[model samples]
Target: MATTNIWQKFKALIPEGSRTIVTITANNGNGTSQAQLRDGSVVTVKGESVQAGLKAFVQGGEIKGTALDLAQYEVEV
Candidate 1:
């Protein structure tokens, strides 16, 4: 799906300006992948993901744990 569509879906799952931690997993178009985001809560994107001004944010910088699949993520309050 397009980034906009994914972002819209994510927004519907969360509120605006809500403090949250997001984990993204980039799909390699393959079957095998890793899993993360043990928390079931949802989060919001804090910044843009691309130059097109996409409303997508990735989990990194300071947040430590494990890598997550870009396809699957969770928000933790």
Candidate 2:
């Protein structure tokens, strides 16, 4: 018998959220902004220039195959 398994790849770019940890890749202002994770974890990003609309990349996670906001559980950066 041959074991058959299927795997899928998912990718998305999401905006910053309340329970998200974000790092400033590039900031153009005072650079005092920061983010927090849902698990009470934190991460920081420093830069002198930031994009107008900050976004984050998420992947390698299992979804329920439903239409929902995955960013809620993702770290913001």
Candidate 3:
């Protein structure tokens, strides 16, 4: 007899922290900065190296790296 580990299987499909594209809204002058998401909500991210008015990839509340300044579009289903 074998046990069906459904929980583990589902967990494996989920990522620890999905990366997101955000624009640097403001710099706190510290090691952290504020970023605005696609939904227009702002959140603090770890990293001030990237100046404002630029885009970056954030993951787990930290700045993973810089992202290309590309325009985004939304479509209706």
Candidate 4:
């Protein structure tokens, strides 16, 4: 006899919210601002008033807080 498992029926799950560091490009006003990712993608995130040309952490379409202005290094594998 063969046994069936229910867990195998589920596909690999991925988290909906992921945090990323971005630079504030512009302020949209009303407690929102536009940010640019490291790959040069611009996205609008909601959070406290932040000045443009600053780095901040964004998650779930919202800005969690500011991030350090450290140098970025990329590695190829």
Candidate 5:
């Protein structure tokens, strides 16, 4: 499914008129990808990914435990 569509569906699951803070983090293994959306809870996604802008990546591969800084990401609602 498209990312917008996924977020639209997920929006219904959250309470109305509220804001949610989430971190979209990706951890890739050889030949595959996995991601986590942390909003005080972790929702893992397989075979899908999050997009980060240039310079958003902090460090990777066990260097800093995150690919992007907290300010570089956006959660669509």
Candidate 6:
């Protein structure tokens, strides 16, 4: 047996209505923004000197595999 993540489980068990939507709320010129999750969970977005961030919400068939590098700040800006 192999371990599977939520993405993979959803694909195998769910047949419909498994889609999720993402909305990006822009800053009010006050350097504030947020990414609203489907469940209404909010994760604050800090406006870096680059004034950039990434909101990647994935829900689908399979999450092949992933690599995360938080030290070098590569995933999100």
The most accurate candidate by lDDT is: 3
lDDT of 2 by residue, 1-77 (tens): 97644432222344233232233333336643232334555444343233423443222211111122244455779
For candidate 6, lDDT tens digit of each residue in 1-66? 977698887788866534433334443355544545657776544331222233333235211122
Which parts of model 2 have CA positions greater than 4 angstroms off? 1-29, 47-77
TM-score of each: 0.19, 0.22, 0.72, 0.70, 0.23, 0.26
lDDT of 1: 0.35
Clashes of 4: 0
lDDT of 1 by residue, 1-77 (tens): 63467777877987445332344333223422222233744333223232221122334322223333355556899
Q: Which residue pairs clash in candidate 5? A: none
> Candidate 5: RMSD over Cα atoms?
12.9
Leading candidate by TM-score: 3
lDDT of 4 by residue, 1-77 (tens): 98877666553364457889999999887788989998898888898556798899888989888898998698999
Instruction: Extract clashing residue pairs from model 4.
Output: none
lDDT of 2 at 34: 34
Between candidates 3 and 5, name the one with more favorable lDDT.
3
RMSD values for the candidates in order, in angstroms, are 15.3, 11.9, 3.1, 5.0, 12.9, 13.3
Order of candidates by lDDT, top first?
3, 4, 6, 5, 1, 2
| Residue 62 in candidate 6, Cα distance off native in Å | 25
lDDT of 6 at 57: 33
Better of 2 and 4 by lDDT: 4
Error of 5 at 12 (Å): 17
Q: Estimate, for each residue in 10-55, the C-alpha lDDT of model 5 and write its tens digit.
A: 8888754433233444545542233333434444333223342211
Residue 49's lDDT in candidate 6: 20
lDDT per model, in order? Answer: 0.35, 0.34, 0.92, 0.83, 0.37, 0.41
Q: Supply the TM-score for candidate 3.
A: 0.72
For candidate 1, the C-alpha RMSD (Å) to the true structure equals 15.3
Residue 43 error, candidate 5, Å: 1.9
